[model samples]
Target: MTAHDTATAARVRALVAEELPRLVGIRRDLHMHPEIGYEEYRTSQVVVRELSDAGVAYAAGLAGGTGVLAHLPGEGARAVALRADMDALPIVERSGREWASRTPGRMHACGHDGHTAILIGTARVLARLAAERTLPHPITLVFQPAEEGGGGGKRMVDEGALDGRHFGPPVDRAFALHGWPDLPLGEVGTRRGAMMAASDRFEVHVSGTGAHAAWPHRSADPVVCAAAIVTALQSIVARNVDPLDAAVVSVTVMQAGEAMNVIPDRALLRGTYRSLSEETRSMLERRMTEVAEGVARAHGCTARCECIRGYPVTVNDDGAVAQFEQVARATLGDARVRTIAAPVMGGEDFAFFGPHASACYWALGLARPGIGCPALHAPDFDFADEALPTGVELMCRLALA
Candidate 1:
C-alpha cells in the first residue's frame, strides 16, 4: 500500500478505536435483552434511537414488521445498502457472561448483537463524513428483523426496503456480514459464488396395519418400513448426487409406536436437505420422495412425503467480491483478509437479496488464538467483543467504496 492508503487506514482505525467502547456497550445491552424473529419490537426501537442519534433520516415500521430503514444522504447519486440482522435465536443462554440473555429461552447465539452494533457505529462514522461533505455516495442502512428462518429479508425486499423511495435512488448494490467462529479475530473471509447453501425441509409419514407381536405375516409393520426408508434416504446424497458437488440429507426426527410389543399403524419421519446447486437441490428433493415412497411400498405400506422449500443459495456477485476484497484488504491489511476456502452448508435469509441486487455477505472472524470460541448456535456461544472494531471499520469502508 501507498502512503496515502496507509494514512487513510490509520485515520479510520483511530476513529473506530474512539467509538469501540460505546459500541461494545450497546452490543451487550442488545445481547442481554434478546428478541426472536419478527418479534423484534424492542430491538427495532434500539436501532431507531441509534440512527436518530446519529442525525440520519430513517423510516420505521417497514417490512410489514419491526424493521427499520435509514439512509445517510450525500451529494452523489450512487448508493449502496448495508444490512444488519436484528433477531436472536430461540436457544437459552448458557454463556454465563454478565450480559448474557435476560429473556428466558432466547439468546443472541449467532452474533447478531455484534452485527447491529457495528452497523450503528458505521452509521455514526458515515454521518460524520456526510457533515464534512466527504461522503462519496448515499448509504442506506437496512436494520432487518426475523432473519432466523422467518423470511424477514424477503419481506423487507417486498416492502421496498431497497426501493430507495424515501431514502435516495434505489440501491445499486447490497452488502451484509456474519460473524464466523472458524476464523481468528481481526480477519475477514469472502468467496466468489455459492457462499451458502439452500435449505429445504421434509416430513414423511408411513402407514400400515397395527398388530400384536405374535403376528408375523398378519400385519404390515410401518416401524420397520420407516426404519428402512430412513436408511434409504441417505443414498440420495451418497448415490444420487455427484461426488464433486455438496448436499446433505439428514433424518433428524422419527416417531413411531409408544409400546414395545404393539406395532403402531403410523410412523413419521422429518428432516432437512441442503445443497448449493439448484439442480442438486431439486434432484435431492425428487429422489428423497421416490426413495421413501418406493421403500415403503416394498414393505406393503403406504408413505406420504411433503417437502417445504426454504431459502435459496446465497450467491455472491463476482464484481462485488472483487470490490469487497479491495476494501477489506486496504482497511484491515493483507494479513487480516483471507479468501474463504469453500462454501458452508448453512442457509441464510440474506440469500433473498442476491436476486434483487448485487449482493455479498462476508464473514467476520470472531475466534481467538489459544482460546477457541464457541461455535455458532451452540448453547454457550457468545459474540466476541474484540471483533467489534474490525466489523465497524469494514462496514464503514465498504459503504464509502
Candidate 2:
C-alpha cells in the first residue's frame, strides 16, 4: 500500500476507536425516535446539532427541507461526497429492546438511523482532519432524507445540492453505506456494477359495465379481466425477457368489488417492477400495457396502465469500486472486504448520485453470531450498534482516500 493509503487506514482506525461510543448513542437515539419520508424534522435537527458540536460548517434545510449538507474542504481540487439516508420506514418497533421506538407504528426498520449516525461520525472525523490540515481532497457530507420510498436523493439533485460548492464539478467520487442483516458482522460486501435493482411502480385501471349479479351476461366483468391481465404480466418476464436478465413483476395490490354479490364497475391493480437493465424495464412496461389492454378488450372492458419510474439501478464505477476495495481492505483488513458476485433486487436512491458522479454504495454487515437479525423493512428490524465502527471507518476511509 501507498503512504496515503496507510495514513487513511490509520485515520479510519483512530476515528472509529474515538467515535464508537458517540456513534452508538446517536444511532440509538435516532432509532428510538423515527420519522418517515419528507417529514424528518427531528432527524434533521439531530444531525445539525451533531455537526455543530463537531465544529463542521454546514447548510441546513437543503432541497426545501429535511436535507443537510456539511462540507470539509481539503488541499486538492478534486472532491468526494459521502452520503447517508435519513428516513425510516413506517414500521412498528418489534425488536423487544429497551430503546424501542417511542413513536407508535414507526421505526427505523431499514437502518437509516445507523446510516445517519455513521455519516455524522464521519463528519466529525473529517472535521478533525480538516482542522489539523491533513486532508488531501474536499469531502461533502450529504445527510439526505427520504431514502425509504421518496426519491429524496433525486430531489436533492434537482435542487442543486451536488453543485461544485457542495463538492466540485462532476464530483470526483461518491460513496454510501447500507447495513445488511444477512452479512456477518465486521465484513463489507460490494460489486463493481449493478449493486441494486431499478425500482418502478405501475397502476392498472380496468373499467367495465356494472349490472346485477343475476344478469352477468349484460355486464362486462373488469375483475376477471384484471386478473387475466395480472397473470399475463407475470409471463412477460418469464417468456419475453431473457432468462439471464433479472426482472421481477409483482402485483401487490388488487381491488375490485365492495360487496359480495354486486359486480363492481372498475378494478385497480398496483404493483412494482424491478429490473437491472433499461431494455428489460422498457419491455416490461410495454408488455404490461399491451397485456392489460388486450385482456380488457377480450372481456369488453377498457384498461389503462401508468408506470412511474423510481430510483435507477445502483451501479458502482470500476475505478470507484477498486478504490472502495482498497479503502475497505486497509480500514477493515483484506480478509474483511468481501467481493459480491451478484446484485440484489432491492432499490436505493443513492443510485441517483451515480449519474452525476462516480459512485460506490456498499453494504455494512450487521449480523451477530448467535442473534437472528431481522431483514430491512420488517417491523422487527433494528440496526446493530456493533456495526457503527465499521460504518464510520468505511466513510472516513472513502473521504480521506
Candidate 3:
C-alpha cells in the first residue's frame, strides 16, 4: 500500500475508535425502542437525524414509508452502497441486557441495530474523509426496513435506491454485513458463491370427516394423515435432492383439533423450505406439493399445499468478494479475514440487490458459542457492542476501496 493509503487507514481507525461509544449508544437506543418491518418510523428518524447532523444529503420516507437513502458525493459517477436493515423481530426480548427491548413482543433479535449503528458510524467516518478530500468513491447508505420476512431490500430496489433516481450516483456495487454468532470476535468471513439460501414458506391443509371419539371406524382422521405427511416431507430432502446439494423442508407449525375427545374435520400444517439455487428451489416446491397431495389421497383425505415465495438466493459477485477480502486483509490482519467454506442455510432479503448491482454479503464476528451470544432470531440473542469499532472501520474501508 502507498504511504498515503496507510496514513488514511490510520485516520479511519482513529475515527472508528472515536465513534465507537456514540455508535454503541445508538445501537442500544435502537434495541430498547424496536420497530417491526415497514413500521420503523422512529428508526428512520434516527438515521435522518444522524445524516443531517453529518451534513450528508438523504431522501427518506421511502419503501412503504420507512426506508432512508443517504449520499456522500465524490468526483465521478462510481459509487458503493452500504446496507443495513432497520426492522426488528416479533420475538420478545429475553437477553437480560440493560438495553433490552422496551416494546412488548418485539426485539432486535437479529442484530440489525448493530448493523445500522455500524453503517451510521461508517457514514460519519466517510463524511469526515470527504471533507478532507481523501475518500475515493461516492457512498450510498441504505437503511432499509422489513428484512426479517418483509423483503424490504426488494422494496428499496423497486423504489430506485441504487438507480440514482432518488439520490446519489448510480451504484456500481453493494455490500452488507450481518453479526454472526458462529465466528469468534474480531473476525470476518464470507463465501464466493451463494452466501444465504432462498426463503419460502408453505402451508399444508388436510381435510377429512369428523367423528365421535368413541368410534374407531367412524373417523377419517386428518391428524394422522398430517403426521404422515410431515414424516414424508423429510424424505424429499433426504432421498430426492442430490446428496451434494442442500435443501430443507421443515414443518414447524401444526394444528389438529381444539378438543382431545373429538376428531376434527380438518388439520393445518405450516413451515418454511429453503434452498441455495433456483433449480433446487423449484424442485423442492414441486415435490413437496406432490408428496402432500399423494399422501393425503392414500389416507382417503383431501390436501392442499400452498407455498409463498420470499427472497431469492444471496449470490456474491466474484469481483466484489475479492475486493472485500483484499481490503479486509489490509485493515485487519490476514488471520482476521477468512474464506467461508460453505453457504449457510439462513436467508437474507439483501439477495434482492444482487441482480441490480455487484453485491457481496459478509459475516461480522460477534462472539463464541457457549457464551452469552445466542443464535439469531432467538429471544436471548443480543448484538455484541464491542464489535462496533471493527464493523465501522471495515465498512468505511470497503466503501473507500
Candidate 4:
C-alpha cells in the first residue's frame, strides 16, 4: 500500500474504534426491540435521532413508509449511496444473549440491527471527514424498511429513493452488506455477478369433488391431486432445467381438508422458486404452472397457478466489485477480504439498485472460531458485537474511496 493510503487506513481505524462503543450500544438497543417490514417506526426514529445527533442532514418519513434519507457534505456532481435494512423476522427469539429481542415474536435473526448500526457509524465517520473536508463525493445514507420479504428496496426506488429527480443528486454508485454467520468475524465476502438469486412466489389451487373417507370411486379427491402435483413439481427443476443451471423448487406450505373423515373439495399449495439466471427463472415459472395443471388434469381435478414476480437476480457491477475489494483489503488486511466461492440461493431486494445505479452487495462475517455462530434466520441467531468496528471501518473507507 502507498504511504498516503496506509495513513488514511490508520486514521479510519482509530475513528471507528472511538465510535464502536456507542454504536454497539445502539445496535444492542435495536436488537432488544425488533420491528418487521414497513413497521420500522421505532427503528426509523432511532436512525433519525442518531443522524441528527451526528450533525448529518436527513429527511424522514420517506418511501411512503418508514424510510430515512441522509446526505453528507462533499463537492462533486455524482453521489454515492449506502443501504442498511431495518427489519426483523417473525421468529421468536431463542438467543440467550442479555440484549435478546424484547418483542416477543419478532427478532433480528438476520443481523439487520448490526447493518443499521454500521451504516450509522459510517455516517458519523464520514460526517467527521466532511468537516475536515476530506470527502471525495457527497454520500447518501438509505435506511430502508421491509427488506426481509416485502421488497422495501424496490419500494424505496419506486418512491424515488435513488432517483435524484425528487430526493437528491442521482446516485451513481451504491453498496450494502449482509451479515454472514458461516465466515469468521473481521472478514468480508464479495462477488462480481449473480451474488444472490431471484425469488418468485407461487400458489397452486386444486379443485375436485369432495369424497367420503370410506368411499373410493364415489367422488374425486383434491387431496390426491394436490399430493400428485407436489410430487410432480420437483421435476420442474431436475428434469426441465439444464443440469448446470441453478434452481430450486420447494413446496413449503400446503393446505387441504380440515376434518379427519371427509376429503376437502379443494386444496391450496404454496411455495417459492428461485433461480440464479433470468432464463431459468422464467423456465421454472412456466414449467411449474404447466406441471401443476397437467398433473391435476390426470387426476380428474382442475388446477390454477398464481406466480408473484419478485426482485430480480442481484448482479454486481464489475467496477464496484473491484472498488469494494480494494477498500475492504485496505481497511481490514488483504487476508480478511474474500471472494465468495459460489452464489447463495437466498434472495435480496438490493437487486433493484443494480439497474438504477452501479451497486455491490457484499457480506460481513459474524462468526467466531470454535464458538460456532447461529445461522441467519435461526431463532437463536444474534449479531456478533466484535464485528461492528470492522463493518464500520469498511463502510467508511468505501465511502471515502
Model 2 C-alpha lDDT per residue in residues 1-401, reported as the tens digit of each score: 78766766776678678988888888999999999998999999999999999998888997659999888867677678889999988777788988899999889999999999999999997787677656878788889989887889988777766777554443668999999888889999899989999999999999999888887898999888888998889898889989888999999999999888888899999999999978788988999999889889999999999999998899899999999998788778899999887889999999999988899999899999898578888888889898888888778878877
How well does model 4 score by local distance difference test? 0.89
The regions of model 4 sitting more than 4 angstroms off are: 1-6
Model 1 per-residue lDDT tens digits across residues 110-221:
9999889999888887786567556667888999998888888888888887877767888878999999999999999999999999988999999999999788478899
- Model 1 stretches with alpha carbons more than 4 Å out: 1-11
lDDT of 4 by residue, 189-247 (tens): 99999999999899999999887878858767999999999999998888998987789
Residue 14 CA displacement from its true place in model 2, Å: 2.0
Clashing pairs in 3: none
Clash total of candidate 1: 0
Relative to the true structure, how large is the alpha-carbon lDDT of every model?
0.89, 0.87, 0.92, 0.89
Measured with C-alpha atoms, the lDDT of residue 232 in candidate 3 is 94
Each prediction's TM-score versus the true structure: 0.95, 0.96, 0.95, 0.96
Better by TM-score, candidate 3 or 2: 2
Candidate 1 global TM-score: 0.95
Ranking by lDDT: 3, 4, 1, 2
Residue 319 C-alpha lDDT in model 1 = 88
Model 1 accuracy (lDDT, Cα): 0.89
TM-score of 4: 0.96
